[model samples]
Target chain A: MDVDICGPSIPTILGIASEQVHASSTGWSPIYVQDNFGVMSVGFMLPSSRDAIMWRGPKKNGLISQFLKDVDWGDLDYLLIDTPPGTSDEHLSIVQYLKESGIDGAVVITTPQEVALQDVRREIDFCRKVGIRVLGIVENMSGFVCPNCKNESQIFKPSTGGAKRLAEETGLEFLGAVPLDPRIGKSADFGVSFLDEYPDSPATTAYLDIIDRIKQLVD
Target chain B: MDVDICGPSIPTILGIASEQVHASSTGWSPIYVQDNFGVMSVGFMLPSSRDAIMWRGPKKNGLISQFLKDVDWGDLDYLLIDTPPGTSDEHLSIVQYLKESGIDGAVVITTPQEVALQDVRREIDFCRKVGIRVLGIVENMSGFVCPNCKNESQIFKPSTGGAKRLAEETGLEFLGAVPLDPRIGKSADFGVSFLDEYPDSPATTAYLDIIDRIKQLVD
Candidate 1:
């Protein structure tokens, strides 16, 4: 479920932005891409993609609460809540709403830069204070292999050792690092799985490895 | 004013994270970077850099309102409000609160990618609906010049002609593009001015040009 209410890009990234949520006797049905894989986002309810959701914290919290209560998410192994950066209203709302239900842990994603790592550190602290476990840290845009020269460039130079060092310091597992691949963003924009399209890419390999680790930790 | 309550970073970026806001008879004093320039952020109020501010929208809005009223901003030529991404509470609160005071416009900063551009487009739509003028768009991380080969690479590849095309498509001014210079982030993290640190760099040149354009537009 895409809980990033302000900018719900899950629909866009999942190639389901055009789909809408259908309400029935059961409840609001999640638009399924596959028989088992289903998704829900405020993006589906938008009159238009360009329309801004000019909602305040309380109203946003209401929608999120309603989303959990109303969405007919059937037979789910795990309900991952994708949030935007920062530990604000949406993050608080989800945690509070799910306190009884319980959140397994949070997987922190950060760019290979001190600036972003700083935020991730704060997020980890937030997880601790809120009693949520941090599964691990995943470094993204760790390095970019120049398509022309094949020389890897630390595009977002991790001034402070990036997520690996961060995880080590925090005593958490370092999931993996995904190299900078422009095609990954393109695939996301087109709503296609990068893993499926670029099966042999380093980024895909890294993502798969990270996915495996997360599965082992959670499952 | 740094209105990103959950993650106020203006202090860290300005290299003044160690300083605290001194409240006296005149109200809160903004930490000065120079003789003329001063900044205020919630970072200064933090007990520590690693602490997370888990505030909801209403509480954040209240603090923002208090900041505006309590801060001893004396005489100001222009009060710039730096906001986080998304068209949510903080965005709406600022617009609503400033509607009576009259806001000049918004300076939208974005990266050279469709994903970021999509958000910029939504933000512009938000500006229109909120009756705020979009001064222009400034694209950051447009390209990276490899240090070894000195060959330019569109690191965050402009899959759709970057922000220049988006500006043209939306009938907004394209201020400039700041090439990816990792030093820029380093400088910000350390609270030093990248322009001053690397006076001869192309990123500095782009920033100076963009600053000039923004000054002309805003003034």
Candidate 2:
């Protein structure tokens, strides 16, 4: 489930942007990629791809509440919610609304850059203060492997020791580091799975490893 | 004024994260980088860089209002307001508050990716709907130059023609495309001006060109 009301890219990233939410007798049905994999995002409700949902906090919160209440995904092993980057209405609203239903934990993702690490600190603090269990932190765009030479490059140079060091300092689990593979963006653009296409890629290996860690750490 | 309440990166980006906000008899003083370049951000108010501004819409709106009203900018050529990416409370509040004083125009920044372009569409639409004049669009991270091989790579591939085509389709000005230079990020992380450090770099050239276009188009 994607609660990123302002900029919901989960559907687009998952390559299910064209899929729309439909209501059945039970409740609002989330778009299903497979029998087991279900997805929900604001993208599915947009009238057009270009159409912007120009809403403020109150209206956004209402929709989020409705999403929590109405979205029917029966007997799910886990309900992973994707969020926008910030400590704003969505974050607060989600925490408040999910206090009863419960949030297993938040998997904070950040780039291996000082600027990004700054935000991660605040995000982790937010989780701690609000009683939300932080599962771990995932360092994305850790390095770029040049397609031509395969020589690794620190695209966004970690000026301050990056997420691994940050995890050690903060006592948060450093889930894994995913290398910047151009195919990931291309796959996202094409609405295809990068893991499926590039099973042998370093990024794929990192992602799988991270998933394993997250599962072990939490559910 | 940095109205990005949640992630106030302006202070960090400007290399004044250590500075604290000081109130004068007249109003609040914005931290000056140089004689002419004055800046303000929530980063200044925080006790530490790691401290999170855990605020919702109302509180965030209150602080934003204070920033607009109390900040003693003292007559400038331009008071460029940096914002977080989205059409949320901050966006709405800024538009409403600035309706009387008036906003010169908004120069939307985006990347060369389909997913980013989708968000840009929403942001542009938000600006249009709220009667904010969009000066133009500038594409960042358009391409990356391999420092090792000097070979160019599209880190985030423009799967759907990127900002240039998006600008063309929307009939908005395409200011320029700034290539992803590691030096640029390094400068930002270190709180130094990329333009100053890499005066001769291609990214600097692109940024200067875009700045010129923005100044001519708006002010």
Candidate 3:
């Protein structure tokens, strides 16, 4: 379920923004995606697309708790949560609520820039402080390929050697690097996955490789 | 001073991450930048570059209060705060603390994409709900220019007509649009303003125009 309450982009990203959430006798049911992936976001509850969620920390916590406890998430092997970028209230609330559910740890995402890495380092520290395992780091937007010339450009120059170097320093496993594919944004806007749309794209390969690593880690 | 506690990007953007905050008789002093712009961010107080701030709402509120009350701001013409994306705890805390100070209003920023505009509309609503004036909307990353071909590309594609259309729909003043410049990021990394570095850039001209409008509004 997508728990990034403030900016719940999952519905939009997955092209299921039109889908509505329905309440059952027990709790709220998530919008089903593909075969087995059921997704839920505060975006579904918004009045309009232009509406903003101007809520405080306690209110945010309340919504998060509802998503966790009130959602009838049937039997599932994985319930991946796309959290907002930070180790703030949302992270605390989620960890606290799911203390007994045995969360598999956090898979932090970051770009190859030092500015981004600096923030991500804190995320790893947060996981450790909260007794959550550090799954690994996935470097996104690592490089961009020019549509015209097909030449690769490091727009966000990896001054600090990207996440691999970070993994080495922090003793965390280096998952992989996902290059900047313009198609990725397009795919999100169109409500599809880059992997499904561009099956042969390098990003798709990278994602598959990352999934393999995750499977091994979980197993 | 940038009050976005969880993800304070000001220090990195200004290329002044190395500067440290010092305590004075009155309170904590802000890091002075070029042209007498005093800056303060939680990023300055971090132990290391990689250290993450895993704080909750109360702690964040405490820090925000300290930044406002304990900081030796002295007298200034403008004390612009670059808040994090969303109208959450930070926004509430800042507005609450600065209630007596007569905050001019909020100058909302967004890109020309439905995805971004959707969130910004809520921000405007937040300002209205909290009695904070809606200064206007500034569209950032409206377009990008290719260095090789020098052809402008609407990378984010203003599918929803961006802030101008948003302003038109909401009956609010449309500020202006700032084109996406690669140099902007580079300048931030190098600790300089794109306006100073690339004075001839379109972005610089747009910034000047925005400043003129802001002067007219505030004065």
Against the true structure, whose TM-score is highest?
2
DockQ of 3: 0.56
lDDT of 2 by residue, A1-219 (tens): 898887888888888999989988888899988889999888899898777787878898898888888888889898888888888788889999999988899999999889999999999999998999888889999899777777789999989999999999999888999998888988998889999999999899999999998888775
- Total clashing residue pairs per candidate? 1, 0, 2
> Pairs clashing in candidate 1?
B15-B191
lDDT of 3 by residue, A148-177 (tens): 666566666677687889999999999999
DockQ of each: 0.69, 0.79, 0.56
TM-score of each: 0.97, 0.98, 0.93
Ranking by TM-score: 2, 1, 3
Pairwise DockQ winner, candidates 1 and 3: 1
Candidate 1's residue-wise lDDT over A169-214, tens digit each?
Answer: 9999899999998888787777889999999999999999999999
* Share of true Cα-Cα contacts across chains kept by each model: 0.59, 0.71, 0.50
Q: Kindly report which residue stretches of model 2 are placed more than 4 angstroms away from their true locations once superposed.
A: none
Pitting candidate 2 against candidate 3, the one with the higher TM-score is 2
When 1 and 2 are scored with DockQ, the better candidate is 2
Over 4 Å off, model 3? none
Candidate 3 residue pairs that clash: A52-B122, A122-B52
